[model samples]
Target: MSALVPALEVFLVFLRLGLTSFGGPVAHLGYYRAELVVRRGWFTEAGYAELVAVAQFLPGPASSQVGMASGLLRAGWPGLLAAWVGFTLPSAAVMFALALGMARWGEVEGAGWLAGLKVAAVAVVAQAVAGLWGQLVTDRRRAVLALGVAAALLVLPGAGAQVGALLVCALAGWHLLPAPQSTERGLPAVPVSRRVGATLLLVCGAGLVLLPLLAPLSEVWALLNATFRAGALVFGGGHVVLPLLEAGFVPALVSHEHFVAGYGAANAVPGPLFTFATFLGAAQTQMPPLWGAVIATLGVFLPGALLMAGTLPFWAVLAARPGARSALAGLNAGVVGLLLAALYTPVFTGGVRGPRDLAVAVLAYAALTAGRLPAWAVVLACAAVGWAVL
Candidate 1:
């Protein structure tokens, strides 16, 4: 009964965050810091920083991983589940509902509002690229690495190339880049055991390998496989998942316009940007809408959840290793490159049709970075402008 109370508390707190946290992944981190670190004191500053580091080092939504870690520290395994469900439920529901609307109103493809949403995606992704570049491309080596990865993807352009670029960057970082100094803060004591962590990691690996083979069986399998791969390989942050998901679903599963629009809608909603999967899943025509939403949401989130849980027990050891740190640095730079390529292709090309559209995007970018408007407000403003002018 006492344990149950803690898990319930975890759920309620995260549910509130899901309902209210906005502005995308970076902003979501600030909200988490304020709520958990400042108000409730669930973790010390250094402890929370350590948790964030672990999430960034692993492939998943970094903010969501931090939430999971917080829940695990507070209430054990039950807390982890509780945290994810609470934080994810609100946005997932909203995105799925939007998918339903799109399904029914097939003519919305030509709607001005939809076009606005697509255009808003341009500014949103540009903001992400700029932010990531500032953080990841700190040195000349990292800049070269990021530019090289971007150039490679621009030339070749596919999921295979993205993955290959990440691999090459990791190797380069390991061999050439200097190791980053370890942070002084120690990790909090997590309840997971090393054995359990190892088992979970094995499951993540097995899914990556087996899901693809099983994808030929049905639409459900294919949806699960694609979403799972996106979750597993996404390294930097939620925005970085864009190109991977775009590669998996665009044109074939979901239309290009719908893809861009859904991404824009994702910015307007609270909680994890990864909930964008819920919208994509439900929007697909091959499977039952609700069922697709459920499966896609689960598949995209599962790998990250498993990896975060598995790595918690091993994080202390890994954080101390210089080689691991260097590789992660390289991988992060590669991620910036991947996002840069995506911004130009699907985000820019899909959204901007003329000078008018470019003007709207520039204004939207200014509103976000300079005016400091909330992302939802900016998205809504862009939609209005796109409807009236563009």
Candidate 2:
């Protein structure tokens, strides 16, 4: 009963965030910081920063991971599950509904509202890149590293390049960047045991390795494998997962038009951008829409949950080390570069059709950064603009 109360509280709080948090992963972090750190006093500022660092260091949705970690700290394992479900359900439901509509109506090629959503996505990704660049690329060396990563990916675009750039940046940061000074503040005691943490990690690894082998057995396994790999391997979540997902589904399972449109719709909805997987799963023709949604959503989210639970017990010691901090710094910059590349190729290319679309995107960007309009509003305004003008 005592445990259930905190878990339920966590659920309601996250459910609200799920409904209201917008502007992509970075904005979601701000919401989390305000709600969990400032309002609830669930964690000290330093402790919260450490939690963010751990989430960013892992290979999944950073905002979702942070939320999961917050829940774990607040109310144990049950809290972790509660936080994820509450935070994910709203957007997942929205995306699933969008998918159902797309399935029934067929491809919505050149639809003005869809075009507006795509254009809005451009502004959203641009905002994310600008925000992240300011936060991550602090020094000259880091800036150079970010540029190099962007250039590399733009020149040779693929999941391989994305993953490789991150790895190289981590190595560069470890070897070249100055070590960070140790902080006195540490994380609150996590509820997980080291043994439990190790077991979780092992399970996560086993799923990553084994799921691929099982993918040939059925469409369900194949979908799970693709979504799981996307969730398990990507460094920075949100827009960063775009390429991996495009590679996994586009032209094969889900059409290119639907893929781009769904991404745009995802920006319009509140919650983790990862719930875009829900859209993809439901939009695909390989299986029943609801079943695909269920599998894809669970598969994509499972790795992050597992990784966060597995690493919490060891994070304090790992975070205390300077080398880890330096590497993370480099990796973060690389992520910015990756987003920069994505902004150009898929986001910009797919969103902007001509001068009119570009104009709409520029206006939307101004609305977001200067006018301080919320992302959902920007999305709607862009859709309106697309409907009326574009």
Candidate 3:
């Protein structure tokens, strides 16, 4: 009953987040902080922020991590499930429906509402960068790292930017910054039974690499493996996932044009940026719409859930060990650089298209930082403003 009540409450909170939370993962953090921490007193604002940072540093969706962590804090595993469903279901449903509709009706031409949605997405993501920048880009050394990473990625072809940037930052931070003051406060690293850990890793790896090879099942397998890889290996949250995802689908079977279009549409809708999977799924040539939706949804998210479950039990011990601790600290710093580069690529380049778009982004940022309006209101208003002005 105690468990049930908390789970139910979590479900309701996530449902609300699902229904109204606009903006992507970064903005979603603000919404979660405001609602879960400030309004409900579920956790300290610091705690929530830390979780977000850790999630960003790790290799899965930021918003999903937020939900999972929040649930674990609130009611253990069940809470995690509630948060996952609450966070993911709404956007997934919308994207799935849209995919089905698109598959049947074909692409909607001259979609003014969608155009507005894309414009608003730009503002939303830009606002996310601004908001996170305040949290991440403190002091000079880190700032330099951020700029260096952004410039490098911008200049280099197939730079493999995010992970590369992270590695650099981690090395710099390890050598430069002193050990953190708190011994007790650092994330607890738990070690799993090595046997179990090895087995799970092997299973996940086999499924991830091999699924694409077996053909009558190739499309289905490819969708699953690619998304699972995104969920499993590509750390540093949703924006970071953009590069990995783009690489996965583009110029292969899926056209670059479709990739761009689906991402634009994904940004327009509410819920997690991970819902972009639905768009990818819907676009598949071989799968039926229903099958596409199911495959996409599971393919994208399952690996993250499995990885987290497999990892968290052992992560505590591993994180605290001297070598692992040092490495992870560097990783954290690297994540800062990665996020900085991401700010330039997808969030800024995609969002700031012209003066009108720039104006909308600026206004949206101001409204978010100064006015403290709800994120949903910002999303709706920006959509309207984008339509009116653009």
* Per-prediction TM-score: 0.65, 0.67, 0.71
Give lDDT tens digits, candidate 2, residues 161-220. Answer: 777888899899898887655542435688989899999999999998899899999999
List candidate 3 stretches off by more than 4 Å: 20-66, 103-138, 154-159, 183-203, 209-267, 273-292, 321-334
Better of 2 and 3 by lDDT: 2
Ranking by lDDT: 2, 1, 3
- Residue-level lDDT of model 1, residues 1-390, one tens digit each, is 887999999999999888766545645665575567645778754456556556756788888988988899899999999999999999999999988875544455566765676677677767767766775578999999989998998899754576678889878988888776654233467798899999999999999999999999999899999899999999767888999899889987999999988987786677899999999999999988999999999999999999999988887566558886787677767867766777787677877899988988898889768886655566678778868876
The 10-residue segment with the lowest total lDDT in model 3 = 182-191
Model 1: residue 186 alpha-carbon error in angstroms: 6.4
Clashes of each: 0, 0, 14
Candidate 3 C-alpha lDDT tens digits along 226-341: 77777677665565567777766676646787777777667767788888887777777776867776777777776666555455555555555555554454454344444445
* Cα-based lDDT at residue 390, candidate 3: 66
All candidates' lDDT scores?
0.80, 0.82, 0.64
Q: Which stretches of candidate 1 lie over 4 Å from their true place?
A: 103-187, 317-390
